[model samples]
Target: MVGMTEINVREFRDYAAGLAQQAASLILTKRAEITATDDIRSHSQTKTSAVDPVTEVDTAAEAFIVDSIHRDRPDDGIIGEEGADIPSKSGVSWVIDPIDGTVNFMYGLGEYAVSIGAMVDGQYVAGVVINVVKQTLYSAAVGHGATVTYRDGTSTILRCRQETDPQLSLIATGFGYTQTRRSGQAKILQEVLPQVRDIRRMGSAALDMCRVAEGTVDAYYEHGVKIWDVAAGIVIAREAGAQVRVPEVWEKNSARGTLVWAASAELAPAFERLLSSVGANGEID
Candidate 1:
């Protein structure tokens, strides 16, 4: 029987890593099955939506992961995108987004991911984000460095972009749940477009943050992102030498929205300025 003492950070990391790998394999196989036969009956049957674009894959993946964790660490709590909310103010809590890019998944685009993060007393200690289609895993622990392992078994250390000039930096952003929410996002984009090198609207927030960690992008910011959406990615980005801050640090009541800024310290100020100029209520300046 697994006990609390046996469920250390290392053990949880290894266990989650294994499960993520297995889930990735399953996703690939399922995708291939749909592609080869052109029969999506199985896939269609499992397609359920909590919101318009969110689907059963999200719930299934979350349930599979939460169940695995509970089997070994029943005392630990879970906060998942699909399951009932479990209070996370005490002990160990795992935050999960089974499939981070639901729209991409529904459209047969292979850009979604599985995100998991473990926190102790509201502070993230370890996290992992797996790009199932790419068979890549990004992982980090509080004191340990961030690393990305590819399907070829090669692992590389990740670091955030150091580009100081906003005109030369590549930025990533995402829209919120509602059309009105997107209006605020569009306003921020319009403000930043002329200043930044380019903007990418990647569907998956987790993947967008991983891209920041991998140095493929300079930074990522989004509004209305849930705790699960950014929790794991935040750890990965910070471990990769990126500066991460919630909105509250720069303004009062900023935590009410999902605002994350990730970039090298050299460029964080400029990015923050842009965010402040366009973010809701312009509170970051």
Candidate 2:
């Protein structure tokens, strides 16, 4: 009983990594099949808004991940972007984003990914993010650190870049689908862009966070991303020594326009001060 409740972080990390890879493979195959014979848009639909799209592959991949988790970890709960909800009796839960960049995947941009995370008592302990197009995998077990496996099959431990100067930092960011949120984000970026070295807007939130973890990007911040969009990434970034800020796991309303940011430990303080000066600390209202 106590052993089962202990929730082994390594075991959870392994589970998340395996499931993310399998789901990424499923997404790639299905995406190819969909595009080979028909217009990608025909297989997708809008959810929160006309711009907020979800594709058939997204649903299919999520179903595959949910079923796999249910079969392997029966007592664990699940919360997925495609509406998978399962209650956990084992005090462990999975947050799933089957395809983190649906629009990029639909457009063949090659920046989308599959993200999976395990949380215990509202705290993330293990996570995996598999970049479908990049053929890379990122995984982390709490207190054990994080690692990224490259397309060439080489793997390396993850770490945030060491930069104390905010003006020289390369930042990554994303925007919301709604015009109101977009308008608000534009204002935020106006203030943020001049303070950083430059800003890169990659369509995928999960990948942006992973970039911060892997030192490819000095920092990342955005508004309106949900738990599924950044759960795996939050763990990966934090384990890689990035300072992370986010709303509670249960705070699922992206419409509220909350802020999420991750920066290297060396730069986090100055970055926070910069954000405060620019008024990026609260919701986008």
Candidate 3:
């Protein structure tokens, strides 16, 4: 494994800040065309089974990003959602969720995105999530703060809502892979709905978390998210003054787990209590 490298946070931020912009531009330029969709679809060798849906765009984007990282920071390792997990040579690993909300993308919903996060010695250091269709970029670095930039070159600091009333908070959540998982998620929703202002199912975990980070939504909780799905958003959310946690603590296997993000620390307890009441264990595997 790569030992941690001491690098200036500003340098890291500058390197990653433009990533979402570039990705967004590329995706937008290619959208709504058969060749583009076919190119994206062809990447999936596996049939759209009930278990997983892999697309051509996912693989291509991962390859594109991995190559970019290797060229820019040759010492860093990469853990992509669709590719092999390689150990880091520089104590910093780049996590990639190349095309999140793939189902939406395949169906032309345009809600899918590219998410990238850098983890140093297993700790999230920086991340970027780009809404491909909207050309919106959300990025953050530890101690450097978080920002959202639009296609027009306008930017603003992201700040999560500090609402303390659960009954007034707008919550967001997602369904997992299996029916059993769905049932458990439903149970949690049942418990939390009456207590919160309302709930939304946006189908894109990365974008949903960004909404929370930007205060467009008050909180977000989901079961069984991969590291790539949340890694970058976690950094952005936390930097935007949101409270985040992997629902439970364990001696090992902390990298993959259920996650909760809320506007305030005080709101997390209520959400966790709801999950506990539903017999939901915050484990992802």
**Weakest 10 consecutive residues of candidate 3 by summed lDDT:** 247-256
Cα lDDT of all candidates, in order?
A: 0.74, 0.89, 0.74
Error of 1 at 207 (Å): 0.8
Given candidate 1, what's the lDDT at residue 282? 41
lDDT per residue, candidate 2, 136-194, as tens digits? 99999888899999889899999999999989999999988888889989998999898
Across 1-285, the per-residue lDDT of candidate 1 in tens digits comes to 222343465665666678777766766666665668763334543322233355555666777787787787777778887654665434888888888887777677889998888777667777899998888999887777788999999999988878888889999888765555666678778888898899998799999989989999998887766777777888888889888775432221223445666786677888777777765434222
- Model 1, 251: alpha-carbon shift in Å? 18
Please give the lDDT score at residue 8 for candidate 3.
Answer: 47
Per-residue error at 184 for model 1, in Å? 1.6
All candidates: CA RMSD in angstroms?
4.7, 1.6, 3.4
Q: Can you tell me which runs of candidate 1 are displaced by over 4 Å?
A: 1-7, 32-51, 88-90, 247-257, 280-285
TM-score of each: 0.85, 0.96, 0.86
Better of 1 and 2 by lDDT: 2
